[model samples]
Target: MDAASRQDADTATPEFTLRSVLVGLAIGCLLCFTNLYFGLQTGWISMMSLQSALIGYLIGKTFTHPSFTPQENVVIQTTAVATGTLPLAAGFVGIIPALSLLSQETDGVDALKLSWLQGVEWSLAVAFFGVFLAVPLRKQVIIKEKLAFPSGTATAQLISVLHQTPLPQPDGLTRRRGYEALQSDDVAHEETRVVVEEDVPQDVEGEVVKKEGWADLLYSFGASAALTVAAYFFPVLFAIPLFGTHLAREWLWSFSPSLSYVGQGVIMGFPIALSMNVGMLVGWGILSPLAKLSGWSPGPVGDMATGARGWILWVALAVMVSDSLVSLVPVAWELVRDYTGHGKREGHEDDEEEPPERLVPLKWVAWGIGASILLGTLLVWVVFGSDGIKSWATVIGFVLGCLLSVLGVRALGETDLNPVSGLGKVSQLLFAVIQPRNVVANIVAGGVAEAGAMQAGDLMQDLKTGHLLRASPRAQFYGQLVGSAVSIVVTTVAYSLYTRVYEIPGKEFPAPTSFVWLNLARLLRDGSLPPHTGQFMLAFGLVAATLAGAKAHARATGASWARWIPSGVAFAIGFLNTPSFSISRLIGGVVELLYRRHLAKTHTPPGREIRLIIIASGFVLGEGVASIVGLVFRTCGVGAASCWGCGTGICAGCG
Candidate 1:
């Protein structure tokens, strides 16, 4: 290729097209609606990146004149996934359960529903912090430090293969060979240097390779639909749950295996599943019984009985927040001193070190951050009764949330884990102490921190994908901005409709995440902090604080001890919720590990690996689709209310 051709090939691909935006929005809206619906039902969030990529690739084939580029397809997938995982939907998913539980005066259905105006305003107030907060860290974390964003790497590789984009050859190497050189011994020599024949990427006789995109997608979709039907119908039809088990058999002690849990294992891997189980065991086996023996009554905290779970949550939050803040201790001085630019290091010159180009300009991002914070400030003040104490506390929470957002992004960029609830609890704990009497005020403040951290972490993932794909960062920023805006409106209407249609926080939806925040806020706000064990919490907090320090120390020194120690937040969350979730996740991880072992031994056919992933993703998507369909039926009053869940009743928990 000529220099100009190579330069053009290396430039950002065709992007910001109207058709691309429309397709993305269409795909994103479906995913946004379904993800919220599914999350409310299953407590899992499925990202649509890979799914969107495959669909976009197939759909792009129809626009033959321009021909769809891999880069453009990325825009479609990015926008869809970004929209699907918006902060407000997540916030509502978690918080609404607690809100529902809070308003249960006499087990009345739909007794208290937060207005669409209230829900949207609360989510809008601070959700924007995530998008802008992530922009600044790309240069420092993704490029300069080169954090391992595994998901981004996978997406980039997938795009490269799908597009057949040329992999660059080292300069001056070529497939050119003369017959004369091949016939002579002197052919190996180029003046004093021996010439080595370079391996070329392609050959003139190469056969045309075709992909079975349509066949594979159709087959996968069919299988997914079939599975969804079986999963949905078998339980209600036979009075047996196929997805998972909560029933106790006379001979069995542990709970049932969950397919969704196993699917999560496939996505999240073994370590996380194992760690989560550790927390469950500690909570259910060790702590719950112990707390019960200590004269504590079983009270409701979300879906789980309030036992040692409450204490575990408080201590875990304390540990995790400390660990999150302390992890940045080394960079703290540099950030405060010369954050305008990275400080000096050996062989690093300020003049030579070029920062990665940004999609959205730093100034615009900064302005957006300030504006978001300001918007959140006004919303919090107004929502919390226009009180001076609450408004000012909100401002302080938002500023702290912004600082924590950096940490949250860093945490996710490094660990593929964001301590979102932990950050919120930090705000909750702080605000709870400061304004002990004001539970609602405390929750609003914590919600800002949680929303900021969660969204920032999510956006960081998109930024990582854009970086790897050589995409326009600016385009991605706009896509996400647009997507989030659309998600807000769509999620608002969908969630509002759901409340009217279903009795939430009932047997159908546990809303585990919201349970923690809502219960904690209510407990603190109502002066009903349970178990009557302040001294134990104090001692546990001290120990947890020590562990948090140890984690920081281990990271600094590259100690092996770090791996042995549990994730404070995960374990704490596990302890606070039911053992079922943690145990099921562990089982899922084990299943995944076994499946991987089989794959390693079998050497599956080309694209089978990708197909297998699609199957897993499709399982998630299938269930989500089923849930949405069932929800629509329930809304239309065609759903069954039978004891055995017959007729139009798709899921047993449906209202």
Candidate 2:
């Protein structure tokens, strides 16, 4: 073939096709709604990239003529995950609800109300700046520093595993010869290098091994979805009375038959699950009883003040804050050292970086960042009012957001935990001083930080996925842009719908994260906490620090028992919610242990390596989608009470 024809053949396959974008939008819209529903209920938004990529792959394979390529799957997942995170990005699960609670406390005098139009505009304004912030850092973080970004890395590995077939070469060209031909150009050379040297799972001379798990995945998905649908109607099925009906109802100690919870535990694995169960036992079984007996918290079970739930929240927040801050010490030190010329070396002189032409242009990204900052400030002034938040505070908040997002990215890259909440608290503290005694200003400023950290970390993670797949960074950026636009509408509408249907911070929809934000803002404003909560907070903070230190040391020393070390973060999560959630998670952990110790040896199913992940993902996805569907059902005047749930009284402790 001639030179032009050869080059055209090399680049024939498209990564950013119309079908990819359309399919991605559809998936993203579903995930956006699902995440909002799930996040409000559990205070956790499960990662959606792997699920999206796998589902997108399945859909393409089943429906599309040519089938979806690995690069296209990367785009689909990148868009979908970014879009799914919108609820958090839009502050629906955290700041917005927190602000609403605060307004209620102040008798509607300080409410920062927004119409649907304003909500869409506000979310749009704050979201894009973070995407812009992530662009320039892609090379430094993903390529040069080679930060793990575990979720991103895992997604990339899955994609590679899914598309392990030998690349289609020219009519008679050998595999090596085809690679050599692509190596003539700089961009193609970089792609060829990574593919041949790092990513390709098979040898040049080896036969391609096709991996198939569609039948198993589909079966599990259908089963999980059906269960989810059934549980919505019955509700009592998931609230299993494992510890007698009284303790299950009053102390929230039931074993949940929730596929979603178990699925989460499977992904989290045994160590974290054990920690969460331990936390649930200690916080609910031990501490909660003690608190009630001692009269520290003597109100009803669900009361945010003078109740077991309220008391434990402080303890959980203390653990989470201390653990997150202590964990950041090592990362912070490295970042400081890097700036001071003593950083740990990551790459060698021989390493080849992607060509400039393939990167998101720095000049345009910088302009976009600046533009987004102005837009954010303008929106804050308009929505919150100039009196509520000064123009200067908004600018400072965004700057602080950008700075903290770097830390957020570092944590996410190293440990797969974006400490957005902890980082937001930092912003809240700063704003407490900057806009003293102003609760509205405090929460809004913190919103900027949380949104920035979340969006920046999310985009960076997506970029890392693209990097591994040899997908164009520019295409991924565009995909993110489009997905973000969809998120604004989806998240706002979902939040609006839910608020109309149910009272937030109520029994059914206890938004845990919002309470954290609300309590902190209240403490800053009122200069006090409930009862003897201060003592408990101090004690738990120390324990959290100790556990965090121990975990870090265990990992550093490569201890044999390191894997058994309880994660402080998981412990905090356990403390944050009801025991039913944690108990269900432990069930999944037990299953994981069984699978590891016995099932793997006994069962050699097709796609044995990824079977667990597929099944677990199905459970999570099925429940999330079903929850959204249920929400719609409730909104359409089909009250949940009409079902065989708490209203019909099949079981005692439905809540």
Candidate 3:
């Protein structure tokens, strides 16, 4: 809060410190474990943006020197979010199971078996493609076009609020000026320098104590971690049910509370919650049950509903691709026009401020991608390999990946929907045409695009968060780059541990995305689908996808009524995963809505919303910790069947 501290705050020296990297890596490991567990459990991956900033703010306060800036916390979060999201985004869990399944199915496929080591390398390599794509495109898409990445924007707001410690510079009012600059949403550093040569203004209450901010963060962290640890051990050791269940399930049978799912609902708000409920209701309750009654469904009600969701999936993919085409035509035409001098070329705005310093140069990024590709090609050749076709496959696959990466980011910015799984099909179709018999080629080529597009889109989103915070792109790039390297080891361990403990694609963990990808690969190879697939109904899906895509395009372009179009991704995923999870989300949405109404009706106090949200976020994080501890004991061979007992579960009775 002093002048010397303010000067330190204004500089960027501490952004890449040892403490930042280590802490970021540690948090990234925890999130990597959490995301890996949940992706397989629910066919969805959790993000670490807000959670990282919130926790980083705590460390910045009680842990770090008073001069720690907002940008430094951002550096911490960039790495954490990168490590957490990239595995799922880059197709680690989804593709790995498919590879494992294929290795078992084919006679010589065991030669192509993906070890955990290969999994990490492949993830990192594909992510390299994403980085190359995002780095250059950040200016074009985020700055010039100004896409609406809501989550990223929200994170920027969070950073602004939480990192308002010890203001910068007495004479200049630097902290206040810097914040006002950030409000532009397309801000540059020059816009932020409003100097006032005077002593720093004091609050009405006099010499302001900043310890309250740290206290709030610390208490919230402690309470959340405590609840999480308690909930975790009790269920395993004492057989005391902690995971909360829903409406009628508790009356009829056993269940556990998933606080995390509910928290997701709270974050996503009503539209997502409503969509999930409707998807479950229509797909699981009515249609799937009816199909079962008529002998048209398979397995359980959830499994049977997946058959209908199969119908939805293809339609969604078709619609998504078509929507991409609709937007692409105009952009393509404009580019052509500009190149041909058929239209006036727009110049950069003279009023705009200079961009912040970049850490990784463009040349370095380009070369890094090219080199990583070559190394990746060699590794792939050495592993499940090729007839001199790996490099060719990688090059072609990466080209298409760049296109899909652009499209995916644009679509996500517009509608928060990116058909990441769909990106794999571009590779599938390309390989199918080039050499239909090359199964390894198909998986590798398609996997490249899948990983590249997903990562690129993820990077673009993160950059948007950075852009809003006026954080340096280079600093974030370095953070993520190191994080990706660290993840190669940690994620591999987590994936191996989970696979060993619980069989994926099994009764407990369905791994629905894995099944989808594997079946697609099968369809590409033999033009056949497993029994209960309803492959005959794909035509219906195609038509539905086209119509839905048209509707979405309309919605994006300002046809508010078109918002009624059911999201293909959400609909299919909601139905395919357990109905109870969706139900929990719906409950969270209801709670959030009611709380909002209460605030409006009674006019709540200043910190009320913040307090409630902190508690809720605490529960969400606590659930993640609970999951980690449970996994730890399970990985260590603790639990039923491991211990010889009157009851195999972890009770101490009857020893």
lDDT of each: 0.56, 0.71, 0.57
- Comparing 2 and 3 by TM-score, which wins? 2
TM-scores, each model vs. reference: 0.77, 0.88, 0.78
Top-TM-score structure, candidate number: 2
Backbone clashes in each candidate structure, one number apiece? 3, 0, 5
Local distance difference test, candidate 1: 0.56
Q: Candidate 1, clashing residue pairs?
A: 262-588, 359-473, 359-474
Q: How many residue pairs in model 3 have overlapping backbones?
A: 5
RMSD of each: 10.3, 7.1, 7.7
| Overall local distance difference test of candidate 3 | 0.57
Residues 1-655, candidate 2: write the lDDT tens digits: 7654533442456877889988898888877876776678777775477778777877886789898888888889888877878888878887787777766554234655567877887797687888888987776677667786766765665566566633332112122111110000000000011112233344321222123456656677677778877776667776666777677656766666888788776766666678878988888888888788888889966577778888888888788778877777776888999878798564433332345555689898989989989988998888888777898998999999899888888877765667777788889989989988888888889988778877898778788877766677878888888888888988888888888877776666778888888788878887787678799889989988887778667756757675566666677777777888887778777776676566346744323445666677777777877777777777786643423434423242244
**Higher TM-score: candidate 1 or 2?**
2
Q: Per-residue CA lDDT of candidate 3, range 1-655, in tens?
A: 6645543444545566677777777777777877776677666665666667666766666677674577777778888877876657555566666566555354135534457777666666665667667787777666665666545655565565555432222111122111111111100000011111123332210111143444544464466556555544443322222332232222111223456666656655555567667756755555454555566544443331244434333333333344334434444455456459785335533311224354457788779778877776666666555652466777777777877777667665554445565556666777877756556677667777877777776667678777666567787888878887787777777777767777665544566676566555556777754344344235435644665556556854878655445544455555556566677777766776677678657855333444434445555666655666767876786654332322322222211
Candidate whose lDDT is highest: 2
Alpha-carbon runs more than 4 Å astray in model 3: 1-14, 103-113, 165-256, 297-359, 387-389, 437-440, 529-565, 605-607, 610-613, 640-655
